[model samples]
Target chain A: MRNLADEIERFILRKLAGETNDITILQRNELADELSCAPSQISYVLSTRFTAERGFIVQSRRGSGGFVRIVRVPVQKIVYNKPDNIMDYCSPEDFENIIIKLNSERMITAREAGLIKYFLDVIDDYVNPVEKMRIFRSLLITLENNS
Target chain B: MRNLADEIERFILRKLAGETNDITILQRNELADELSCAPSQISYVLSTRFTAERGFIVQSRRGSGGFVRIVRVPVQKIVYNKPDNIMDYCSPEDFENIIIKLNSERMITAREAGLIKYFLDVIDDYVNPVEKMRIFRSLLITLENNS
Candidate 1:
């Protein structure tokens, strides 16, 4: 929260945390007003932080009633059981460790682990570190609950 | 046996081989005449060989002046070095088995395999199986060669 960029990222991440599938639909101008920063600053942060390499999919619409939606998609809510701080910023390795620990304790079967691992394998390709965590958590949760 | 399709396939592969990152482009009808075949045959080989799953990104333009561009993209070649049959229709398990064998043989380290496994974990989630294959193969190849 030191810099404006980090602040915006945090605001978005926090908003996404309480969402289903880790997706948050919001307007750029409203977010800029809330952050007391320029709208272009929001765009800058998003462009650099939320990227395909980082696992974020950002879409925008222009003109009246236009909006910007930042989505960390295909991720569901059950993966992160950590404290809010940790859950807000997690890693793929963090996910791997949790699943591995779960498997070791017999909380999940090997097949389930494989399925969870499969989810991890796919979402890990997303590049945004912050988004990577939420995406991993949500997908793991979905797969865990589904299976 | 020099099947026309195989001949056309080899001709394109050979042409791509001598280029940077192993990419090449050609006119469909022109290549057909060079191989003494129909334009549709060129499309067949490209549709098969230069697939996203097979580690290729093919972009083509239609109409009288249309051309097809076959880009090798960022993936290295060795990931596709399995037997022809294996390469033709490989699965996630096939890739996993290959990496495991390589690990056991110490051709790739546990760390390397882990890295490969990481890529495997993420790319597996791609909805398109063909894209999943190519993305995994290219990333794995890049990791293997770099490490």
Candidate 2:
């Protein structure tokens, strides 16, 4: 049996996949009741799985009108038919698409994909993955704050 | 005389080197008993040595059918060598030399080279360095495991 965390993560991702770009607001108590899990369990799933590093932004308002809002950030997509063509003349869009495909295909490990996403978001150079992730993260922060 | 932790660490590294994907899973208590050390010693070695920063991920499950899995994250390698002839393909030995040349030129980082070595062991493909490394790492863990 899948853990509650994984189940909740899949539920949120399934919902996010159906929509293009929008914030999904859900009441914690209602969500918890539906999942038959504690409110803290929902919080744990959100914090760990739906992190900004994974191309998601989550915000919450606590109180009687308490609700968690999740936004799926738009990311670029790349397509290649053959493995030999994977790295040829990659544009920013191409890189993002490659990452999206890799993640969707479950080709790269989650941690490895996270590292690559970080590079795409931060690094400017067409170089190493570690540096790439760092640069991508920096760029993302700059873009997010400015826009 | 090697400490129990050192012995166990060496044993794990040897196993990793012999394998293509270089990931090893074992039971903590079983390994500890075999090494004549406390289970905490295994944890100590894992914490000190097999860290994400050190290119290893340690995951464990507690209780029935529990096991500790150690996965080594291969580093990425950048290669700049290109063969002249279109028809004549490079052998594994030729590819190995290309890696050495890149390493000597300081074109590829040590971590990148390590990842390349891991990739070479896993993927059997003939292509340019950038594409070869990219494709290999991109699909290393996913392809066979899925089926």
Candidate 3:
């Protein structure tokens, strides 16, 4: 990572993490001055790090008085209702249902959902349903763990 | 991979590889007829494997006489020509350059690049530079190997 870009991202992340509402608005010039980088650099950081697919909504307007607003959205709703070995017992339909729920909740983007749905469809065609369930379950568990 | 899907992918790959130009056009119905599979199955393979991120450009038309077109794009023009063990010898700037190129080439979605770039930033913050290079090199090498 470029040090400046990373610094800008972390700086924004820290600001967002500290906000209870999960929203932050800041000036490009002020942040650039603080970070000792050009304002353009801050814009690049915001555009890349705070994207819609990454669960962030960014609103910005041009002009000196304008500010950049970023809203952090949850990537997933983590609820462990099942036992520890969830993957061992879940069905493919269960996987599909949970993914649909997550998508509905805006945890993952529609593009990702499409990609994953196609993957599942292909896996279903080749693998046994039971084995496919295991794969999907493991993937969900991994995402949860990572989250 | 599903046996039929794999076969179809190989068929397309062979067609592309054999092309004097880096483009191929074929009707989905014709492919399905040859493979003895549903036309939708051909779509699944095309959408997944021939994605822009995977260095492909796909164009399609619908209705009767519609055709699916595939274009093979170079991925590695994004970066290369470093030493045999460049990751062991390069700086974070090198890593950033590679990723930026990949993003410009649409080899990875911006969200993925942001995730990676942010992770690298945190790693740079806490980890020694040498260790960071090793990680960066390893990621690039893995991608190359997989490609």
Candidate 4:
């Protein structure tokens, strides 16, 4: 039997692959009914599978006419010959490629991507893991919540 | 009389300024007694003042050998002689200087600096003012959260 998280993730990916761009809205209760799960289960799926890192922007409205909208971002096309060299050296072109790809692939909303790019520049001059993690986590959380 | 809030805040800040990184082993009840305040006051101070937003991290243990530890983070120095001089013209040398200073002062972790350099490349590529602000805010928030 497929678990709820897996089900939700599959459903979301399917929607993204199908070219659903203008906010795929779903009501919590209605989705729960359709999936035979609790409303909180929907929240769980949104929190985990649709995180900013993996690249999906989720928004919701509460009360009547309430619905959750998921936007798909586009992925960038950069020819990486070696995956091992991914973070070895990050240049402006590399960062831009990632952002462009993330936006196009629907991994991040335009607003979230914009925010992330801004943060990347500010911390660019600093060289420390603790600080990088700090910035990365903060941007991730903000994008997750705001998107 | 200085209230518990004021006293605890001062004590924590003083310890932090004195280069104390670990303070979790301190006994709450004993601390309250030393300050002639209620134990709950300590809890209140920890929750409100030492939050991640304030750049202080707090952790506590309960039961036998229970204690509270607080770590104070040193404030980041943006490094320009004038605060009004926006970081628009920072050279590679300037960037390197900031990293060295932060590392020597123990202000940022090595990983954080690496991430920052990655982000810097992104900022250098973007020419738009709005884009710059967004990136700057994102990096600042990330730095603030990590430290």
Q: Count the backbone clashes (under 3 Å) in each candidate.
A: 11, 15, 0, 39
lDDT of 4 at A126: 50
Better of 3 and 4 by DockQ: 4
In the range A55-114, model 4's lDDT, one tens digit per residue, is: 556888898898888864322212233252245455656666766775675555454455
lDDT by residue (tens digit), candidate 2, A1-147:
346877888888787667766567777889889999998989988988877555577898988887898986533221335352444355567567666675675434354455444434322434455444343434333333321
- DockQ category of candidate 4: incorrect
Please rank every candidate by TM-score, starting with the best.
2, 4, 3, 1
Measured by TM-score, the strongest candidate is 2
Model 4 stretches astray by more than 4 angstroms: A1-147, B20-30, B47-89, B93-112, B121-134, B141-147
Angstrom error at residue A142, model 2: 17
Every candidate's DockQ is 0.03, 0.04, 0.02, 0.05
> Which wins on TM-score, candidate 2 or candidate 4?
2
Off by over 4 Å in 2: A1-7, A60-66, A75-147, B1-37, B44-69, B72-147
Q: Over the stretch A15-81, how does candidate 1's per-residue lDDT look in tens digits?
A: 8898865567788888899889999999999999987446666878765456777776322122333
What is the TM-score of candidate 2?
0.38
What is the DockQ score, from 0 to 1, of model 4? Answer: 0.05
Report the C-alpha lDDT of model 3 over A9-121, residue by residue, as the tens digit. 99999999998767788888989999999999998988888876577767776653577887775533222333343445446676677667666544555544554454455
lDDT of 1 by residue, B78-116 (tens): 445557324544576877787776556444445445545
Every model: iRMSD: 17.7, 14.2, 16.8, 12.0
The lDDT per prediction is: 0.64, 0.59, 0.68, 0.60
Measured with DockQ on alpha carbons, how good is candidate 3? 0.02
